[model samples]
Target chain A: MKPTTSDADENSPDLLLFRYVEGDLDAAQVQELEARLASDAALRDELAFWKESFAEPEAYDTAHLEKSLLVPVEPRWTGSYFGTWIFILTLTVTLFRPVPVAMETRPVLIPAPVSTPAVADVVTEARNPEEAITRSRMTRITLPFREKRLPETIEVERNVNESIIPAPIPGIKSRPPEVLSPVAQLPLTGIKVQKVKPKPKPIAVARTLSRRQGRAIMRMKEKARQQRKADQFLKGNVPYVVPLNSENF
Target chain B: MRTFLKAGLVWSGILLSFACYGQVIPLGALPMQYNPAFAGEAGGPRFNFNLGLLTASRFRHNEYNLNTSYDQFIPAIRSGVGFSAGYFTSSFPYSSSSEGYKFSVAVAPKFSLKGKYTISPSLDLTYGSSATSWNPRPGTAKPLNLSGYHLLSRAAVLINSRKWYIGYSVDIPLHNTYQYYRYRLFGRSDISPERFNSYWQFGYTFQRSSESKFSFTPQLVFLTGTDRYNRYSRNSFRYFAPEAFSLNFRYGKFIWGANNAGFHLGMQTERVRVMVSNGFGRRGLVTSDGLGSDAYTGNLSFRYMLKQSRW
Candidate 1:
């Protein structure tokens, strides 16, 4: 074996041992040495002599470094040979253990999501519209509402049709600039114009809408409360009927 | 009996990695999910032979922050080139050729003693083609493909004694990635970062290999980066994670690790699991102009490390 280009093992009996530990030997030569050393005695002595040459830091030979570590030995290394062999054997097994087998086709790959699919469905969640209207009224005095207008071709546009007075009695619109007051020029609001009311009272249609919205909100809240109770019941004491099992625990 | 055999098989797989020649082959499809923060960086031979299999595959989330590379997982295998992910099955059986050759090396040859410190430095290298592809989903708007050659390496230190396990590793061009993800969407191939950088991983490890062939290693790693010239990470030197650790396990030739960091998690299963696993990438706090560069990251890989050295 060849010594490494390092000095960590210098002066130690194993100084050159690391050289062999380094992979300086060819496969063919290692095999040849394994067979020859098992039989040849004199050659083994020569091998040991060379091996002992670098036993300490006194000498570092390149020939041994580049060549084989299995030269014939005289009296083969007896300096705890058994222990070193065991360690080497153990290391060899650890390094050479067969890796697990892999086939071409692998198992199914399952994807994991950070956010469950249910989460992205927020905007489309099941909702009680009636409850939403009631909550909106309670939360803020002002709403982010835009002006609504009835289309010219339609009359049931709740916003536009319920605004001010209707267009001049069909055709007679001959009012001068100073003739009519600003209030009188405005379109009439409500089903019929009031002759002289103190202030505009709530429209019947609006009152009806308010009532419906309130009821819807109350029902939504009640439903939510019931759902909570049902969930708790399921989790706390989930009772089950025994099925077709022969044995009982 | 199956458990023991599985353990033995994994152990043998790990041992088979030590041949001085030939290609860099992983012991099994799975190997220890390692972090430079805890592993000794001195490049010698780190053996895991006789360790049992980590039956728990490296099935991990592709969340980068939740976990480190040690927590990624290998995909389950069947035959040929077909694979199943979730409910989707894709196979490229027409050309059963490999993406490309991969080369991996781990060298940690220190057995010497330091003053009051048992120091072991190791070097690890991995470079190969990715075995998976990144498809452009609807409106993703990406062009970074994880194709072509990738290289990652580290030189690190592991100092340990009776009570504690401390480690540090300096990563070099170890994770040189040449990705081409989501190219069609962007109308151009993805570009590789021309800069080089080094990352350091420091952590505590609990290794329990005593006298048995099977052992478990749990470690917590703190990672930091320096020298912006490397340019892998856009941010300056910093560290995060009050609770980011990796649990690496070995059984025979099989090894696995799982890590969770913040909201991201990852897993790494090697050898018998044969993979370069980096999947399940979820959106993080960071936003990008494109999905390819933002979605694809380096993580949870299963690789074969082949090594040879001269004394």
Candidate 2:
């Protein structure tokens, strides 16, 4: 078998040894280098020295870096922070809040007035015949008195057709106006029937058309009038005033 | 599961605190709903995409909605054309589900006034379809399905000045297959499902000076119809530079009874604008399950302006 003497190994065996230590050599180069190493002890020693000097450093501690990446920084409770928390709290409370109960009450019915026998009817019946006859003749005949009674407990539907009259405000005093003796009758001698003239009907200022259309028509008329004036002036129909003073020119 | 959900919510809250800026884009923000004349108001071809999520405490069901639009102005004709599409789906666990899809096209022509103001009048045509499916037990009879189709036309007018804008729009249903079918099926046409809807929008911007970069805008919108009523208002503060940052407070009642009040943060650059908002309100998506239950709503929107030549 031919020795593996590539160009690089022939010029520099140390380079080949370096490649061998770094595991950069192919299988053939490795076999050649190993064979040479077995023959020369000095080459083996040089290879061992290279391996020891070029060895990679041991792994370093990364506890600080891991902490920096994983841990969260504590924030100071500034005003803005406080406000944010407060808003969050309010929102959470609102979101999870219970349904509100409506404030309502049943209507309370007032007790009807206590029932009592009518004394007037009994007195009228008990009157003497003569006095009754006189009273009957002098007074108009009236129907027997009947009182309509409301139920003791009338159930009124709350919030439906219920009238709530506010209490009258306090501190008001009423003063009746003083009546002056009727004014003396106006003297007829001075009263005269004057011929009254009918007031003229108001000028029809109300527009019959929309304000915008009316304004547009007015603008067109004004423009035509102004054009007419300009034309007249240009045709010398209007006289130019002579200057009262030379300096006024 | 409840504890985990609460924790997740708390985490989201914390993240939102860091963001500190967001804005809500109700239906009023959509050109199709508010004013079709708003299409291509930015003067360049633009695309908009939006995502909305509705979740409640008992997370058995969640509702999701998606919307996107494309629009551009043609300088030669002094007119703008816009097209928008939207889809939303909601489900009730193991029982029923409903979904809807809508597509719309709008045309608006611009007219200049006094060399400083713009008057735009637009018309929009829409085709919408909705389907609902009910699931029954294995041994029960066949499932029932209800589907409907509708066509709507909207006319809108907008007046825009340097710092002020006002618009009004009205929606009319041209055709409704559902109502006709329902009338035929049930033998009565008394229960109509569609009615005339009108919208009004007004806004004014306040700035320190013409050259200043900071501005405040207060906007109001009212939507009235025979079937529903909605009121939306927003107060926004914006700081403009190469990039613009804005903060807005919004309060509104959306269709189907979704009422919300929340804060919004937004950022806008030349080509892109992003907005996100979170609010707590009653989710009206599934009224039966969402009623009286607290809900959290989050909306994210993106606007991209494309080069005119590319379009």
Candidate 3:
């Protein structure tokens, strides 16, 4: 069927020609439209008319018009102008008057240590679970006990009538008579412990180690546990900037 | 002749006051105003809105302001982009009113140091316009109106660590249309509205242990400009949990010939923060009667975060 240009529909020749001019028609549509235009003179005239209507007009010179409108207006200083200026002048000075300048001081920067090595790494000794738990529970008390100096030796003055006896100090077993210090002869009762004298014998302090060992272990374990908790926390959270509160002008 | 020169100086000061406020905006409880490098450093895309009201002796002297900002960090490019807008309006006792509008765009790229520290250098381009209307007599016809526009460029660098941050920023006016207006008014051809302003800020955080749910931060900021110098300090405390409360105290010195102090209290959740702040200070009155009058401001801010930061 031949479609007439006067047929008013969505796909009319006029609409197609308009779309074609706007480059909105697909390739097949373009081909069909072009074939129609080639076969019909009236359609060709309509297409040409559309083209002429859509084309942009050529530019022309407007120098004379610009020249006529470019005149500069002279400012006139009248009584009202003077009055306004004086008022503005008064207002500006009154509103923004100067004040005394304060002294300027710089802020002090306090630098923190990057790392602390003494407490960074703590080691715990191997022990039974019960012992470890006990050690961990004993917080700050056990640390200072091991740090203080214990007596190295005791001098016993002999009671001639008394028999030699073992010392009563805990964790220090009785030493043989031959093992006693050369400066002192052993008396069994009312033994007076004198100042800690330097001796070649080293077993006295070692004997007391068994009693202090448990406390030392507990202190280290507690420290190690705290360090572990800190490590876990740091691993999960990374620090970021915290902004300041907003202010008014 | 002396009267004219003094008038010119006073006019410059008045305009400079507005310019200073417009350029160095402290909005939304963030450092993005002074240092663009701080944009999106909080680890996610975020939006903020704030409204403020200022009260003084007279109704005409009161001021109102609205501020909003949005920023996002793009991990793919290791950079951030931000946009901020603000409006401010105030009236003078003498039948005159002034209004200002400001908009800015900022960009910053993050550089990592040792996987624990970050250094970001940023730049911002801002456009600002202010208009003023003067009517010598109220209810009069044909009031005079004057408006001007300006372009400003800012550069800033921030050094951020796990527990500390330091930043510095400088603002330079690129183009000012008010210089021509000033010349036209006073016949002074050599006037330029170019004032150099800079900010230096440092902050530190204190947390006893990771297990502890409380943290404290103290920050100090200093502002130096051609016509003014200001120093302020802010301390903030936050409780970490599903829901938390924050308290902040602030004090500033030499803010327009007045000592200023304020406080902000807020309740926050994982994704939203709402805060109310109040500031009170004394300002030299406009009448220049050598007497100071008290000024107060109340503000509210709402901020939302798209994602939670690791901190």
Candidate 1: lDDT of A42? 65
lDDT at residue A50 of model 1 (Cα atoms):
51
Residue-level lDDT for B57 in candidate 3: 60
Model 2 off-target regions past 4 Å?
Answer: A1-249, B1-29, B135-142, B179-194, B227-261, B282-290, B307-311
Writing each residue's lDDT as its tens digit, candidate 1 over B264-291 gives: 1112232223222121122211222132
Docking class of 2: incorrect
- Tens digit of lDDT per residue, candidate 1, span A120-160? 22221134543532333232233233332323342354674
The model with the greater TM-score, 1 or 3, is 3
Q: What value does DockQ give for candidate 2? A: 0.00
After TM-score superposition, the amount by which residue B200's alpha carbon in candidate 2 deviates from its true location, in angstroms, is 0.7
**Where is model 3 chain A poorest over a 10-residue stretch in terms of lDDT?**
A240-249
Off by over 4 Å in 1: A1-249, B1-101, B114-117, B131-146, B174-177, B180-218, B226-244, B247-311
Candidate 3 on B171-214: residue-level lDDT in tens?
A: 87788675467546644422244345677766654543322234
Q: Which candidate model has the greater TM-score, 1 or 2?
A: 2
Clashing pairs in 2: B21-B265, B22-B264, B22-B265, B23-B264, B23-B265
Query: What does the lDDT come to for candidate 2?
Result: 0.56
